[model samples]
Target: MIATPVSSPAYLEYGLDTLFGRITKRAECRIGLEQVENDAFCFAIRVPSPLSDDLEQAKTLVLRVEGRRLQGTVRHSERLEDDSLRLEVEPD
Candidate 1:
């Protein structure tokens, strides 16, 4: 499902990218959140850039969903046909 991320004055809630305890935000990007099998979370980053371990794709991510924060690890990420990045995350 397509979703607009919840807007917040805090960059961490919107533009901030948390990785290795560091927060970074460059160009703004949107992602669709979905639930996968085994309580995993599918976070889709719709960008043309390829997914890499440098962008924290290989590490755990904290996702804010339904007013709660969930910890997840990106199991795999692939460049979609539409140039988007699909990350299969398993909640931990």
Candidate 2:
């Protein structure tokens, strides 16, 4: 995917992959990309933390996982205290 300065909310779909060579179907996720660093970008995502931990037949543990099918809206953008950019993204 081409990463650039996002002017509008972008919607995308991403595949979920595990470390054990397992792949799950694509899921819907929303994201708002905001210009933060000179070369890096801060993506505000709306995927909440998992509320349950049941590793059984189809349960999974997520850690630093990437998502797709993202849809978001840019509310505002500003500089952070750490000299980084902070973009307020609300899920649409």
Give the alpha carbon lDDT tens digit for every residue of 1-92 in model 2: 23333233333332233677644333323222433334233244232222112111122212122433433444444444543333444444
Q: Point to the candidate with the largest lDDT.
A: 1
Q: How far is candidate 2 from the true structure (C-alpha RMSD, Å)?
A: 12.3
Q: What TM-scores do the predictions have?
A: 0.48, 0.27
Q: Candidate 2 at residue 38, lDDT? A: 41
Tens-digit lDDT track for model 1 on 7-91?
3111112222354564533333334555454543454433334433344344445555445454556677676676556556665
Q: What is the C-alpha RMSD of each candidate to the true structure, in Å?
A: 6.5, 12.3
Error of 1 at 70 (Å): 2.1
Model 2 lDDT on a 0 to 1 scale: 0.33
**What is the lDDT for 72 in model 2?**
41
Model-by-model lDDT, in order? 0.46, 0.33
